[model samples]
Target chain A: MEEKLSVNHLLGIKNINQNDIKLIFKTADNFKTVINRSIKRVPSLRDITVANIFFENSTRTRVSFELAEKRLSADIVNFSSTSSSVSKGETLIDTVNNILAMKVDMVVMRHPAPGAAVFLAKNTNTQVINAGDGTHEHPTQALLDAYSIKEKLGDVKGKKIAIIGDILHSRVAISNILCLKKLGAEVMVCGPATLIPKYIGSMGVKIEYNLQNALKWCDVANMLRIQLERQDIKYFPSLREYTMQYGINLQTLQNLEKEIVIMHPGPINRGVEITSDVADHNQSIILNQVENGVAIRMAVLYLLAMKKTENVKN
Target chain B: MKKRILLDSNHTKIMLRRIAMQISETHGNLDNCAIIGMQPRGIKLAKKLLELLTEITKNKKIEYGELDSTFYRDDFRKGDKFLIPNSLNIDFLIENKIIILVDDVLYTGRSVRSALNSLGDFGRPLKIELVTLVDRKFNRELPIQPDYVGEEVDSRAKDIVEVIWAEENSSPEVWIITDK
Candidate 1:
């Protein structure tokens, strides 16, 4: 028999154990094989229903989640704040309860508030999957990231993965650090001091200010997009100044004189954080991360649904 | 618990040879046929049977593969235990090719049903036949019967049928474990 996750709701990577990560990866391997088949679909979750509630706008996560749900044969109901009753003055719990009344078994939510998904899980009876909740966590993104790394490197232990770019306002970085640390991978956060969080040292990761030094010391560099929309004040002097100090061009990568996998969680600032050539280079796994997103999400949904069914039976 | 031996190593070999001879007699040309085994347990039987089929017929024209249908199982969320899946390793096209589905035991017939559904995703086969070493009569939940059976035995619901192939320091034999 398959082992299920310890926690029912995926609120954050901090709430999960190492066994849960192993279980998710193990299940994703089977799903990776499934998605490669000629008729790519599974009827594992046919009796269940899922609702994707998004308070923030997203293209990749939204499409990836919708595809994952469809391939699992689950009935999907989508909810966006722009077209919902929240505009008039409905509360978050009330909005979720109304959808639960319609019999949605699980909720994949992306909200602006930090603890919105946790709060929803406490108030509702259904399982909650935090797609992204502000700067707190994005569990699924971290999972697919780790899975992509494992797929490329054969293992996550003892491998160096440097998360570059904005660390101050990124939910992906927080989740990634927790996930990679549990999987035994050494992590480093590199960016301007203003963009890096102060308590990052407490998170058990090295902080690098020099892009070239970070590149020389790492095996895989995961460049995150600068959250320009989330920045209300100037984190650095100027975009050009930031690029000159921290941007990774082809020359910068070649200067290291060794092979290092390049990664970017997309909508990248082309010339600021990473050059176009490096992003499209053979070492880049940006597209593989996107492709593995569906399998990873399918694994998350399938495992969580298994727990929900057992709970009902009990 | 009580254990009963049904076939010894010598008898088991004779039974397998008889099954192989029957296949060679029924279908002389295995060029258009694919020998597939169900995952987890059936793989062992399929491998042994394919080796025997090749030796008896002296024909090297048959293709071999392994199939898994854990996703198409009917008792997904309804079962008490979580379902673990094995990797599917069919690297060939079954389009218009005859398929010989192999398994070690024929009880309940649900796994066979699921395997058939899984095979349709590969391609449309000309015909599909089932082969089993042990046919547990009066235990089928579905209307599935083996095209070639090594032996037919009657047993209670809870009795376990075990097939031991000659591998890893053990001789080949068949046993039934029943509780009184």
Candidate 2:
């Protein structure tokens, strides 16, 4: 009944220091144990309702959050953009208020517009978990990425991380860059000149366009999924040209540091952004990121719900 | 809070000796037997058992491992972060080996459920026997019973047992810290 953690409300990784990350990792480690059992369900969030509001289409992130809610024993009400009143021109706030009227305890929202989750949090009494908000942030994905890296590399501090692909359109890359930098890792963003933004370097990240240079200096090469939706805007000459230049393949990987861990935020575009061999390789933490996603989200939800309950009681 | 001495250091040492003797008599020898201590105080208790059992059986080959049920707890996501020590250094294979799962307290049988979950990550054991230093009754939510209990205490829901080891509290004692 004591106040726990609500890590999703964490707006920026810049505010979180090493000790905070350690606490999150420690808490996530405990939840990892809860997931391995035959009877994995816990009564922590019993009778609590969590709304899954997605203003976009998804498979793994959506299902992972739903499963996380169920595992915590919370009732789920899923709202998709296609089925909701958004199709009828209703605003995001109006739809959220409608769900709030039903007394949902928490809302996990993913929208195409940046700052949508933050906006919902300001308007609603319920806790807002940013599953993904346009190109702004996906905190849980970043947390799981950090967790996966910590599990493999023992510590992320001083580790050189090369985040390659469409840096401008990738929420995953943005989150990972912020998180990795906060945890004391030197982050590098490398991609085609059109795809990589120049201002991202202001976030204290080093920018590189040459994949060979980025791959050589990095301890972790994180290949972000190139949002195909952004391709039509002339970000590159062509998909084949982009893959030929920047896609992490067997040849690029061979030139990379052998101990370097490969990572990707899923729904990978095979032969477009990354090669199948590197994605499926032993060094890849892509699947581990998915597994850690559930645990991290569970930790985030439990913490937020418990904190709100404590605030009300107080 | 009532200061109760369920099993003092001496009594615990003697009970561990007797348990070792019984195990040897029934299970042939202590060669294939491993003593796994549950996290926090259970690990210390198991280490103590290993020391006592070694003295009684005169077999120095008894393996000791520690298991942290922090990850395996049912209420893990529900509760506040209570930092405990890391997991056991279990190197040997548990397959076909007799495993004695040790814990400091047994109340509501939930911790044991967590311990069993923690055990499943390791290789399967031929036999797993649950042992607890204290067994408080009428709180079990699961169908689990400890194989060996050092002491049985009748308690209400408000009454909680705090087992302090010298490693943590600078002294070893079992006390009933009551809400009333």
User: Chain B vs. true chain B: TM-score for each candidate?
Assistant: 0.94, 0.84
Best by lDDT: 1
* Span of ten consecutive residues with least summed lDDT in model 1 chain B: B164-173
- State chain A's TM-score for model 1: 0.98
Structure candidate 2, residue pairs in collision: A5-A303, A33-B71
- For model 2, the stretches where C-alpha displacement exceeds 4 angstroms are A1-17, A33-44, A230-232, A256-259, B1-12, B18-36, B54-101, B105-130, B134-163, B167-180
User: Compared with the true structure, what per-residue lDDT tens digits does model 2 show for residues A203-306?
Assistant: 99988989889888888888888898755577777889988989888777776546688998889998887889988888888998888888877777766665
TM-score of 1: 0.96
- By summed lDDT, the worst window of 10 consecutive residues in model 2 chain B runs over B76-85
The DockQ figures for the candidates are: 0.70, 0.15
Model 1 residue runs over 4 Å out of place are B169-171
